[model samples]
Target: MSNSVKTINPATGKVIREFETISDQQLQDKIEKTHEAFLDWKQRSFDERGALIRKVGDLLVENQDRLSKLITEEMGKPINQAPGELQLCQGICHYSADNAASFLADEERDLPGGRALVSHQPIGVIFGIQPWNFPFYQVIRYTIANLMAGNTVLLKHAPNVWGCAEALEDIFREAGMPENVFNVLYIQEDQASQVTEHKRVRGVTFTGSAATGRKIAAAAGEHLKKTVLELGSNDAFLVLEDADIDKAVDACVTGRINNNGQTCVAAKRFVVVDAVYEQFRDAYLAKMKQVEFGDPSDENTQLGPIAREDLRDNLHAQVKESIEKGATCLTGGEVPDREGYFYPVTVLENVTPGMPAYDGELFGPVASLIRAKDEADAIRIANDSVYGLGGGIFSEDEKRAERLARDHFDTGMVSINGYYIAQPNLPFGGVKDSGYGREHGGFGMREFVNSKSLMIAQ
Candidate 1:
């Protein structure tokens, strides 16, 4: 495990730097030290924790330019989006700091015999497994909330963005976090098992593929430990007959292409009712085809390379399979003869059940177009998948559309007449194959806490 950790430049496919994976002894030491920190941290007042957390947010804002550049270099995120991502991280920190105390404050409950209070108390050290797509935002969403709740955190970020992981540890330390209150485990996947099984670790939160989430959950389950698994999604964006075509088209394009189409919540499937299918098809196709990929460092570049070569290969294979299974490519499908790990913006039509592009996630700049017979059929088509993470409905009547979104949409989150992503004050998670548990909003602060009940004698 000594030379196993490598951070690669996804845009150029170059070796950025290779680092040593910490030994079992080193990992054990980190675990112990972090556990020790949690003992003291758990006793601190919410005000004290909130103050420090706000400082973390301030620091992120101050360092946004530098850190954002690093994010782009490491992950091929377009320069314009990198700063936005960091700013969102700053928002998470502030949101957790400002609202966590109230969110987790002791609640007085009426008891039959005596007065009872439900207190949210820190459980212990929580381990996090984060992905690289939204490098800083992903970690901040979970860690900030937990920190405000007085739980020490351990993060094992994706190897491709290890630099960002280490930078986070430094940021926490700079913001006056207690020694070992936040830790970055420079360990591989196998080493993670050890961390999960460690007796001191209380809960685990993972944001990545469902396949990996299963492994982490199974490992933690064996110890009867709590786990929050926020996995992948193939979110459907439905275009109803009455939807504003102009608004719907723009939302669909942005929803699909944001984050180079690597986002878990990015709309992967477009379920349009037949009334406006042709207009939707033509507009979506033209806009999608116009997308261009260039150096992420370029401010003018609208799109960048996929995170890695294998990811690009996987996306192309999905497109190829969909085509072979009778789906027609409306736009970009073939891999471009480019230097970087890039795939052009693609749109597919005639996508149906059983095809990869239809049932599974494409995970790139590829959009699946599924036709529905009508409004009822569109809802059915949207909810026809195993994933229930996020979906959208566009309609002229906001009230009626919201009803469909609230009552008919089976996804954990839905949009009425627009697109949406993770918001700091909103509970973000999904049902079904997208994984279980919630993050963001106020709920995240208590996810790893012990909600102890205290009944006082009258």
Candidate 2:
């Protein structure tokens, strides 16, 4: 096996840096140190931890420009959008730091024979297996919560975003956080699997595809360890008959292309009511075609190259397979003759059940248009999927849309008529094949903790 990992600049398809993967002994030492740190960390008051976490957030803001440029260089994120990711991370850190004490406070409950106090106690080290899509945010999303909960964390980030991982560790150190509290392990998959079975690793949290999530969950389960998996989704964006066509089109376009359409909850499948199918399709296609795919460093570039050459190739393969299966390529289906791993914004109509565009996530700047007979049919179509991380219902009637999202949408989250990547105060996670457990909105602070009940006889 190779002893190192290389990070390539997706925008130029050139190698940026190569990092040496740590040996088994080094990995063990890091894990042991982290567990040692957790012992003292869990004893600290919430205020103490929060103060340090807040400092980390400040550091993120202070270094946003430099870090944002690194993200663009490593993963091909558009220059305009990269800063937004860092801002979200900053928000996550401060949000968790602010609310963790209240969220995890001991609760009093009345019992017939005794009074009960339910306390959330910190577990040991948590192992995080994160992806490259939102390198900084993905790590912060879980790390901050775990840190606030008094548990040290070990991150096995995607190879492509290892640079971001190291930078985050540096930030935490600069913030005066404990040396072993936030560790970035530079190891391969087999080593990661071994770490899952390590005696020190108390829990595991992963974000990636459903297939990989299943494997991780199974591995963690065999050891009787807790696991939180936030897997992929081909989220359906419903366009009801009463939807505001212009607004829905614009939102869907942004949703499908944001993060270059590699997002788990991005608007992948467009289930539009047949009443306004032609109108939405025409307008969406025109706007998608206008999106510029070029250098990620360019301010005017609306889209950027796919994160890796293999990812770009896989996305193109899915497009071709969907087209072969009778899905009509409406626009931007061909790969451009560019130097980087660039794929044009694509739209596919007549996307039926059997096609890749309909069944699987296209994980790129691609959209699938599925027509429905009416509002009921649109809802039905949206729910016809094994993965239900999130979905959107666009309707002019705000109350009706909220009602549909609340009672009818079979997903973990829903957007009434707009696109939102994530919010600091909202619980973010999905259901069904999209994985289980929740993050953010204070739920993440408890995922790796022990909820113990203390009873006192009256």
User: Lowest summed lDDT over 10 consecutive residues: which window, candidate 1?
Assistant: 1-10
Task: Report the lDDT of model 2 for residue 97.
Answer: 86
Q: Local distance difference test, per candidate?
A: 0.89, 0.92
- Could you give candidate 1's per-residue lDDT for residues 154-272 as a string of tens digits? 99999999999888888888998888989999887788999999999999999988888888899899999999988888899989888899899899999988889999999899999
In candidate 2, which residue ranges exceed 4 Å CA deviation?
Answer: none
Show the colliding residue pairs in model 1.
none
TM-score of 2: 0.99
The window of 10 residues in a row where model 2 has the poorest summed lDDT is 330-339
- List the candidates' TM-scores in order: 0.98, 0.99
Query: Where in model 1 is the C-alpha error above 4 Å?
Result: none
Per-residue lDDT for 284-314 in model 2, tens only?
9988889979888988888999999999999
